[model samples]
Target: MTAYEAPALVISECQQGLLDPPPGAFSGLAAQAAGRGLIERTAELARAFRSRSLPVVHCTIVHRADQKGMLPNSYLGKMAIEERMMVEGTRDVQIPAELGPEPTDLVSSRATGLTAFYGTDLDAMLRLQRVRTLVVAGISTNVALPGLALEAVNRGYDVVLAEDCTAGTTAEDHRYMVDNLLAMLTRITPAADVIGRLPG
Candidate 1:
């Protein structure tokens, strides 16, 4: 399949809580991404992809009040408990306003764990849409992005990392994850490159 055939723009954990964290709760990488305008750039890419009739999937994290689906004894669970993040019906878990996932956008919200693919229908939904290539964007490249990319590659889907559209806990960490790890698994390009390649 061609690079652009049935591509899905998969955004991971671009949630309000993480992107715009409460005072003193923000991570350096997230701040860096915001400072570098990753969120705005990603929003533009999402809109461009949507305008081209491409699939736009937003993978978010939202836990129940009881946190039944949340994995315990883990960093994610610890953070959830400490920060009180991603509670069901809470505004913290909502997608950022700028990205603005429309009614037509596919949303995959999971409370289980970090990876968007695990215990989620994201893979199946992409297949249903006949997606051969995935233009991946969003936050925490150190965790979710790599997990998603690995799973996508294992599932035989071509993966492309939207470099300017994602971030980690630190700029160096993000760069290392993307350049040293994810880059080997998937083609890493700027959001503009990915957007420009879309079929008109």
Candidate 2:
């Protein structure tokens, strides 16, 4: 068997929102990350992680054919009717090229709207490769990253979110969520520190 790899990243759809405006689809803080180089930076980080021969996993949200409303447990379930729910195998659910994912990297979940790990067999993949710690990056730091961190920690994995690699709908929203929500669950370390801790 292969050795355990370093922590991996998971990104949410900043280009395609759960719901989007007609002009750009996703126009919130996640959209802002694109304008300010979030995608590029994420890809750059992916490359660095890859160079070390560490495992790099990608996560995206998609829905089943039923395409129904939330199941009452999801944080997203309480949202309004205009929100865009994941419909499996749609264009909005595709992984961005910057954080390229092959057929194996995509994980699916009918219950959890947060990650590709839960409901999917990603935990098995991580365990098989012996990965016990995670370095997470993505859009909507408030929602996606923190939610994912909760899931990972619950499953006995050490998680550190790359603070600079994530963004929210607003600068303050991002800051507040990280300070209040994520801080409660995990450490909010900078991307540079994450790299420093990795193999050189």
Error of 2 at 57 (Å): 1.1
Count clashing residue pairs in model 1.
Answer: 0
Task: Give me the candidate number with maximum lDDT.
Answer: 1
Superposed model 2: Cα runs more than 4 Å off: 1-5, 12-26, 68-75, 78-85, 102-112, 115-117
User: Tens-digit lDDT track for model 2 on 95-169?
Assistant: 665567643353434334555555677788778767777877777775777777888889998787787888877
TM-score of each: 0.94, 0.78
**Quality of model 1 by C-alpha lDDT:** 0.85
Using alpha carbons, what is the TM-score of model 1?
0.94
Estimate the lDDT of model 2.
0.64
Q: Cα RMSD (Å) per model?
A: 1.8, 4.3
Per-residue lDDT value at 156 in model 2: 91
Which pairs of residues have clashing backbones in candidate 2?
A: 18-84, 29-169, 63-86, 63-87, 63-88
